[model samples]
Target: MSNLFTLSSKLAAQLDQELMGPKVGFTLQQLMELAGFSVAQAVQKEYAIDDLNKNKKVLVIAGPGNNGGDGLVCARHLKLFGYNPVVYYPKRSSRTEFYGQLVKQLDFFNIPILEESDDWLQYLKPEQTICIIDAIFGFSFKSPMREPFGKIVDEVSKIDNTIPVVAVDVPSGWDVDEGPTSETYITPSLLVSLTVPKPCSKHIDTAKTSHYVGGRFIPNHFAEKYGFKTFKYQSTEQVMKL
Candidate 1:
């Protein structure tokens, strides 16, 4: 349960720049590659739990950003690991070329991708066993959730009892530093914090939900700069519960 420590959204960005910035740092290309794979591997343990019946399926709600890209990567791994994962990604705007590549890779794997619609909530079948993967928003998200995302988060909240949601980094619609500003935030059964735990994650109810540190790609130099305690996430294993 002990680890490097928690960081605010601002400090999280600072840590990213220190290790993944321009010169003398890992390129976004390299970072994204490692990031996607690490995330997939991190949550693999949960996907294969013996108690989870094979009747359960995965529902991935992805946004059009790096976070969504990570979800796309995770979906593929979920499929290869023997779980059926269907993605709901509304690709309205082109966030970046890399984003396209992520989608392309998902398609290459023959994963089913759905576009955002008014009744996207229909995908969560009440009669069927399911788990959600919230990849909608990451740390950069600001307050006042927008149209599709706001409604989507609210919808997901409604289904928490039937299906457990596993948020990728920060929970969708949650404040990056403090936590959810309102009850509308989607409460995840499992929250996987990449690299290090963010400040807002401190608010998560560890007694009820599982919180793990993932993204075992950052180098030790960055950890030393922040005086981190070598966390054992980006080192020992692909993912470690904190």
Candidate 2:
């Protein structure tokens, strides 16, 4: 499995270059928004349901990075479509600039952030629900879960198996470049990899339904600048066919 999914250091470096370089003109926020929309679109298509923008109950678990910003975007999109999507952002001091901007966007949209004190469990029933969006962690994570975030993951795990989870980028605690963490992790029903599939996608424990999201690829010049290449999934047709 490692041989099949492992990304060499050179390749990983190339990807990072493509992701952060100027040629692509794809900021982290844009990538995140595209990814969130793609995930929502895929969900609607997968369930063979109409009115996706206006249906379903979505619970978004957000962390402190750009991944959390993506979840916030998803929540706003869900609200526009008429779904009651609740966003929970665990308090953290070291948050990304994108996250702060997203918070302001949520405020403009009048979407209230869920407090830890709020009874989130009461709003979601494991057996008779729609979807849970996991955006708690992204590719850069390396440490074990700690404090309130770890506690949040534990609580979310308590949800019955009947509920389906759509994870953004990767599952909260799973490492994209390496293997699973030593601590407890969230197992998403469907894992949505933004831009391209990460090495972790090939892991047997990553997700039952792992799918790649599409966006503009990182340009080669940028990849070269950053010493990595970027690959965007062109399988939207296949996803639509599913």
Question: Candidate 1 lDDT, tens digit per residue, 23-119?
Answer: 6568766666666566666557665634545766678888877777778878877777777778889764385677777678778888778886544
Instruction: Give stretches of model 2 more than 4 Å off.
Output: 1-14, 22-25, 47-56, 92-97, 205-207, 219-242
Per-residue error (Å), model 2, residue 215: 3.1
Alpha-carbon lDDT, every model: 0.75, 0.64
Task: List residue ranges in candidate 1 displaced over 4 A.
Answer: 1-4, 49-52, 126-129, 233-236
- lDDT per residue for candidate 2 within 151-201, as digits (tens), equals 777766666256777777677777876646737777777766665557776
Question: Best TM-score goes to which candidate?
Answer: 1
Could you tell me the lDDT of residue 170 within candidate 2?
Answer: 71
Backbone clash count for every predicted candidate, in the order shown: 0, 6
Query: Model 1 clash pairs?
Result: none
Candidate 1 global lDDT: 0.75
Worst 10 residues of 1 by lDDT: 227-236
